[model samples]
Structures are given as C-alpha cells and as structure tokens.
Target: MIYLTTFLFMLLAYLFGGLNGAILLCRLKGWPDPRTRGSKNPGTTNILRFHHAQAASAVLIFDLLKGTLPVYLAYFFDYSPVEIGFIGIATCLGHIYPPYFQFKGGKAVATGLGTLLPLGMDMTGLLILTWLFTVAVSGYASLAAIVTALAAPFFVEQIKPEYTTPVIMLSILIVLRHISNIHRLLTGKEKKIVNWKQ
Candidate 1:
C-alpha cells in the first residue's frame, strides 16, 4: 500500500500540476493567451510584463497554490523526504509541461517556490528574500529564479539535512527550466523589467 499511495499522490500531483492559471485566466479575460505574448511563458512575470497586474495576480495565486498543495499533501501524509522531493519534482514538471496546455508550460520558479514553502519558513523566507533582492537589483526575473534555485539546496540543507538531496534535485529542475533565459542573459539580449514610475 505504501507504493500505491506514493503513486497516487504523484499522479494527482502531476495532473493538478497540469492546470495552469495563466492560460485559463487569459481565456476568461479575453486577452491574448499568455503563451503568445511577451516571454511566451505562462509564469507570473510574463503575465505581469505583457498584461496588467490584476491578471498576473490571479495567475500568481493559482500557480503558487498548485505548487504548494502537492508538497503539502506529501508532507501531511508523512511521506519521507525523498518522496516529498519526488512529488515536488512532479509538480514542477507538470507546471513546465502541463498536459492540458499541450505540454507547454511556464518556467517552474513559482511552482518550485510553492513546493518548498511547506518545508519551513526559515528556508522559504531566505529564498524569497534572495529572489526579491536579485530582481530588485537586476530587473531580471529569470536571473532571480536561477539564483534562488541555486541557493535552495544550501538553505534547506542547513535546516533539514535529510532533505539535501531532494532539494538539490528540485533546484536542478528549476535551473534547467530557465536555460533559455540564461543564454539570453549571457548574450546581453535578455529583456529586463524597468520601473515606469521611476
């Protein structure tokens, strides 16, 4: 029954992961599907960049919840660190390649953050700060995500040693999802967010 439960959780997590808020919201608001807009990503940053903040807010909440729920479920069920980690992976992948959206999904940053939020506030807080600070200084959401993901394994390991490997796996997945952005950043061709009010 252990294997069955694990399979079920991961399966449900993957399927739930398939539901993306960006695409759904666009359809409802009659806006162009986010996939066709700036960055062509279904992540919040893309939505906020091309669309208004209200639309992006809805997407962010949904994406964050989707990421948070699965890992929270695994944790609630007393799954081992490794099992939780795998569930986290499934959730992120589902976001990256949601079946409902033709397997074309957003970068897994928010989803990954959602999965980790349940682990503990200490690590999660640090992670958020890192992302925020990076974005504030660099104006590059992709760069912020990459930096935070790379920092995740370290902070998580400090607080929960057993979660080190699994967290590292999650981190790797997040980084891989941002490969295109990384290439653009290196070539000086990436678009950076500018504060209009400034």
Candidate 2:
C-alpha cells in the first residue's frame, strides 16, 4: 500500500509539474506564445528575452515551486527517502515534458533546482553557485547548465548519499535536454543572457 501510495503521489506530482508556467503567464499577460519565440523554449530564459524581468522571475519562481511542492508534500507525508526522490525526479521530468505543453517544455534548470533544494540545501547551493559562476565567467547558459548538471550529482552524493541515484538521474536528464544548447554553444551560436533589454 505504501508503494501504491507513492506511485499515486508521483503521478500527481508529474501532472502538477507538467504545467508550463511560463506559457500560462504569457497567455495571461497577452504576450506571444513563448514557444514560438526566443529559441522556441518555454523556459524562464526565453521568457526573460521576450517579456519583462518581473514576469520572467514570476515564471521561474512558479516553475521552481512546481518541482519543490511535490517532494515537499512527500516529505510532509513522511515518505521514505526513495519515495521522495522518485517524486522529485518525476517533477523535473514533468517540467521538461509538460502535458499542457503537448509534452514540450523548458530545459528544466529552475525546476531541477526546486526538486533538489528540498532534498538537500547544500547540494542545491553547490549547483546554484556553480551555475552562477559559470554563467558569470563564460556568459553561456548552456555551459553553465552542463557544468552544473555534471556537478550536481556529485554534490548530492557527498552531502546526501541516500539520494545519489535520483540526483544522478536528474542530472543526466538535464544534460540530455541541454544537448542542443551545448551544440550551439560549441558552434558559437548559442544565445547569451547579457543585458535584459535584448
């Protein structure tokens, strides 16, 4: 019964995570569909490019919340580490492949942060710091994402071994989703988030 309950919770979490918060925000603000502009992604980065920073920040926060809420609920229910891990990973996956977006969605960076933050603040801090440092130094979102994704599992294992597998799996998905960005970065064509104006 516990396993059944966990499965149901994970399913609900996925459904919740699958909401394209940026797209919804865009629609509400009467902005163009985010997926049709700025690298054709419904992520906070793209939203920032086409919309106001405040709107983009709101989307980012909500996207993170979507991933955080499920794992938090699992924890609140006193679910085991493994169950919490499952919920966290499912939430990230749902953000990447949101049903509301026809299984098309963002790169899941912010959502990944959400999922990781509840599991281990140290791990989350390391990932965020790494991403920020990389982005600040190189001005490449893809590079920062790739490096942080590679580093996140290591941090998780070191700080929270019980969640090693789930964190590793989430890292792999993040890296995979960023593959195109990696290619573009390599080819010198990836967009950089310089000034917010464009």
Candidate 3:
C-alpha cells in the first residue's frame, strides 16, 4: 500500500510538472507561444527575454509550485527521504520532457530547486545563493544553473546523507538538460542574462 501511494504521488508530480506554465499562460494571454520565440524554450528566462516580466514571474511561480507541492505533501506525510527524492526526480523529469508538450520542455532549474525545499530550507537557500552568485559574477544564467545543479549533491551529502543518491540523480538530470547551454558556453556562443555596456 505504501508503494502504491508513492507511485501515485510520483504520477501526480509528473502530471503537475508536465503542465508548462509559460505555454499555457502565453496562450491564455493571446501572446505568441514562448516555444516559438526567444530561446524557443518555454521557461521563465525565455519568457522574460522576449515577453513581459509579469508573464515570466507567473511561469516561475508555477514551475516552482508544480515541483514543490507534490514533494511537500509527501514530506508532510512522513515519506522517507529516498521516496521524496524519487518524487522530486519525477517532477524534474516531467518538466524536462513533458509528454503533454511532445516531450520537449524547459531546463527545469527552478523545478529542481523547488524540489529541494522539502528536504531543508538551508539546502535550497544555499543552492539558490550559488545560482545567484554565479549569475551575478558571470552573467550567464545557464552557467549558474549548471553550477547549482552540480552543487546539489554536495549540499545533500552534507545536510542529508540519506537523500544523496536521489539528489545526485536530480543533479545529473538537470545537468543533462543543460548540455546545449554547456556546449554554447564552451564555444563562446551562450548569451548572457542581459546586455552589458562593457
């Protein structure tokens, strides 16, 4: 019965994560599909880049919640760290390759961070700080995401060893989703967060 419940929660997380907020919100607002503009990615950065901040904020909140809500509920119900980690993994995977959107989805940085909230606020905060610090110093959002994703397992190992394996899994998935960005960075083709007058 417990296994069944966990499976159901994972499925729920996946379905929730699959709902691409940028796409749905843009469609509802009669704006161009985010997938058809900017980076051609249905994510907050893409929306904010080519569209309005309000829409981008909405997408950010939605993405965070879709991953957070399910995991938080599981945590509240006393689910094991491993179980919670699996749920988080499912949530991230759904965002990365949502079947509802033809299996193409966002990079899932926000979703991945959101999943960590149920583990510990310190863990999540540290990762967020890592991301922000990287972006501020380097101005490359993709680099920040990559750094944060890579740092997740380290943080988990220190704060919650039981979640190490699951966190590592999530980190790998997040990094894999950023492979294109990684390539661009290596080739000096990746775009920074905003234009600078350097």
The most accurate candidate by TM-score is: 1
Model 3 C-alpha lDDT per residue in residues 1-198, reported as the tens digit of each score? 999999999988888889888888988989887878867889989988887788889999999888889889988999998899999989888888898988888988889888988777899789989988998889998999899999989998999899999989989998988898999999999999855556
Arrange candidates by TM-score, highest first: which order?
A: 1, 3, 2
- Candidate 3 CA-lDDT value: 0.88
lDDT by residue for model 1 (1-198), tens? 998888888888988998888889888888888889889998798888877898878888898889999999889889999999899889888888899989999888888889989978998899999999998888888898999999998898789889899889989888888888999999998988754346
| Model 1, runs deviating above 4 Å | 195-198
TM-score of 1: 0.95
Candidate 2 to truth, TM: 0.94
- Expressed as tens digits, the lDDT of each residue in 1-198 for candidate 2 is 998999999899888988978989988878899888979989888888877889889998998888888988888989988889888888888888888878988888888888887866677778889989998888777788889989987887778898888888888999999889888987989988863445
Give every collision pair in model 1: none
As for TM-score, the candidate ahead, 1 or 3, is 1
Angstrom error at residue 174, model 1 = 1.1
